[model samples]
Target: MTNSTRIFLFFSFGYFVSYLYRGVNIGFSGFLIEEIGLSAADLGLLTSLYFLGFALTQIPAGAALDTWGPRKVNGVLVLVAAVGSVIFALSDTMWGLMLGRFVIGVGVAVCLGAAFQAMALTFPTHRLPMINGAVVALGGLGGAVVGTPLSLVLDVITWRTASFWLAALTVMVSLCLLFGAHDTAPLHNRKRPTMGDQLRGTWEIARTRAFWQILLFPSIVAGTFYAVQSLWVKPYLLDVNGLPGATVDGLVSLLGFAAVFGSAASGLVARRVERWGISLYHFCGLLLALFVVTEVLILLDVPLPRAFFWISYGFLGGTNALIYAVLVETFPRHTLGRVGTSFNMLVFFLIFLFQNAVGWVVELWEPISVGVYPAQAHIAAWVILLALQTTAGIWYFASKQPKKLEHL
Candidate 1:
């Protein structure tokens, strides 16, 4: 393979595994609840804790990636994730599972932040979008290809044993990273900025109108996306829409599959949109609005077809794919890691809060037992998530395009 192609494969493959590690916990969460006898709120708390660990690593992890390179940072962390998987596999208790999940979060946080930095560093500017898209789409394949299968595997192998094997595979990848991934030394030949200075640099950008598009949209996309995927739609369909459990599972599977396409499509769109002076934010936000509209349509008893949800997710994924590149191009490469880390810290916390908030809304509605379905409380939380996404959409359209900014 060509150097560029090799680099893409290397980073993308690592990312594929990273996504697997990140989502494996989410897949097993229901199992944790059923087998461990945890409540919905308790499950929310555990997932939130994972985000807490993920959030804590943002700035530091970013800095490490920028300065130390992905080999030292992301590669090694995947090995740590392997250990985390082992812990999770071994632990049967609630708290122990939480600890293991947290470690996995730490591994994932580093892997993603570094992957973006590396892709930016290694890939050519013009082809960046498609390459980036390929990475996301390919990486997302882990979820699409294996999410449900892995979940089913856990049924046969048990979560712990499956985790053990997954970790072993992750560690092997880590070793390959150590031996195969080469770190290009800094070309600028400049001393690295201190954390305080780096923080200030990002902070200044944060105040500018430009940074708002990058910073703000990600939160909405991540928060609402996680809120829904963490099984909000499943319960909504089962309790409110009268869909069967099998139907819900099939839809959930389709959602992950859609995400893979969304990731790739968004990357390509991001690349193309930048040429037209349109922001990826605008495209994503607009689609986010569409997704919510579909939900509202369903709520109102309109013939809100299933294609609407799938199509909307495609748009959502596309919009999200642009975020990292936006961050990469908007800042100096040296600061990419720091800003990425800081952004991720915020993103995960919001994800944690939003997911639970969705759950809270369900609980408040008072369980309405229908058929085999367990009724959740009020669904006001989903409404709120929809609202947040709408707000993001509004902000995106109101903002000036990147071309407009250049003219000024």
Candidate 2:
């Protein structure tokens, strides 16, 4: 294979493992709760800690990517994540589990950002939207693996054992990336910026009003989608619909499959849609409206077939993939790393808050049985999320047009 293809495949593998680590908890949530006696709040905090670690690493990760390149940065961090997986596999207590997950978060935190940076360096700017979509589709494949496949594996092996094997696999992937992936030539011949300069550059990106306007949609929609997909959705199906383990796995897998197609199609179609005269802002607004509708259905507990709810949620969630393309088009290549990570930091921080808050909401209600929270609690959380998304949609429609960056 060509060097570019090799790099793409290596980074894709890293992302696959990153996503698998992110969603694996959903498959094991029931087991963890039952075996460890974790309450809803405990579960939420545990899961959110992963995102917390992820968020905390973003700014530094961005600087590292710009300074050292994705190959080294991703290679080192993913190894750390591998170690976290091993810790998680060995942990029997809540604190140990939390520490493992947090480490995992920090390790895998660079997966997407590094992949995007590598692609941006290697590919033409116009083609990046499609490339990014494909990478995200690979992430969906990872999610799919952790769904039914993980469930099947769990049936045959304990969750801890599965985690152990996953850790070993992660180590292999990280080694491949370290040895096999190639990075683009440096964009500049000037001296590397000092730490203070890197921080100032990040702040410059953060301070832009246009950045905030563009950020609002993804921060709310992507954050909520991730919060549900990564932790709560499967649990909701189990507790509310009372689906069997195999059936829940099947549904979650279907959602992951749909997300794969959705992300790929969105990336492929974005340029064509722009040519057709629809602004990215309006396109995102349209998708957010659809997402809000799906949340409303979940909020009302409308007895529509389970497939419809899960599939729609997964598909609409893919709309957030386009945000990466928008950022790529809006920023200069020199600063793309920081811009990408800044966006990620906000998105994940919101996810951290949303995941924890949802758990708190659920905790307020008494469980009808062990580990089964009331449907009302879920509905309340969904409603709050839905409202926030709707508000963001309206804000997008009413806000001033985002300023164009001539650097692109």
Candidate 3:
């Protein structure tokens, strides 16, 4: 009925699709590995492709939204994601699954960037931060819904069929965007540069030391956060902590529940940092991660303390919220959508690589001179992540300046 409602719906649709691509993997990973004979490594590598595809399209996606407008681009991308879901459902091999996931990867970058660009184009400037948080919170809801209990539904039916149903939902969402989820004004920025300029966006950012400042922090923050959440947490609970059945479910629920608050909290913090600020928001995140890893290591050395389960939850939740909210504020909005999408791509790619390598690195360490503690190994895994965040902090502090919301 109104412009605001239309903007909200349209943007929500984009995240809804982006998250569907994310959520389905957790639900189906176990089933697929068991049925299709994919190893844990295979599942990690293949699912990571979704992020890679998502990352790869950032610049183009932002430009598409800027030039083509969200209505057309969002519809096409959702349809493409639906196709990925369908392919994943039908696949019996790892390579086939990778192809399917890659489709999702490519489509989701468009979905995420287009949604944000739509918000920037349509919503009032003051509302963008909160609205952006709302989109992520919605996606987290989708993720929480797709966990073990939902996976049980896949048991009764086949996960393959479930995948098909998810795709079908995307198709429904695509229709929703096509008809109801649209704005009155089109984003035809006549003064904007040619398509070639848009395509060179990522490269342009790469050229600037300042871009690296904006770039590396998000890569570490998002990479480690998502990597752990997606690939390792379940195993961390099952293997490291020795949590079983109901306990595992409850813990997973805790992580997701914390995320709900974390997303909103991030936006609020960003708003609060309107004046002079002195903190390594992203680097502090890894420091928090260090605290988490060290605590987990202590728990491993001795008897389990029930307190840790909640304390660790709070620590991670706080970091997650801060990192996300800090993202929008860290860069210029002109290239916000492009940088955001590209950042997601790099985060995904690095998360997959580092996460996969950690295990082997640990194994290699254990047999050699230093006896390996797995928790310590993860702490070490985070060392490089923290260093990158440090580098990012130095750059953000020294080079670029953020504009006030009044100007945005």
lDDT of 2 by residue, 282-395 (tens): 676677678888888876778789798878888888767788777776677778888889988999999999999999998889988888877788878888888888888887
What TM-score quantifies how close candidate 1 is to the native fold? Answer: 0.87
Stretches of candidate 3 exceeding 4 Å from the true structure = 184-195, 272-334, 358-408
Clashing pairs in 1: 58-341, 266-318, 362-377, 363-377, 364-378, 365-377, 365-378, 366-377
lDDT of each: 0.66, 0.84, 0.61
lDDT of 2: 0.84
Give lDDT tens digits, candidate 1, residues 1-408: 555455566677777776676556556766777788766666666666657778877766765676677766777778767777788888878898889878877877766666666777777666666677777777776655344566567668877777888888787777766776576546322456688865675566456676666567667777667555654555566666777655656666676777777777767766576678766556556655666676566556556576466446644554466667665556666666766777777788887787677656555544444212344353466567667777777777777654322211
Clashing pairs in 3: 53-105, 54-105, 55-345
lDDT of 3 by residue, 257-283 (tens): 556555655555555555446443544
Clash pairs detected, candidate 2: none
Residue 339 shift from truth in candidate 1, angstroms: 2.4
**Would you list the rank order by lDDT, best first?**
2, 1, 3
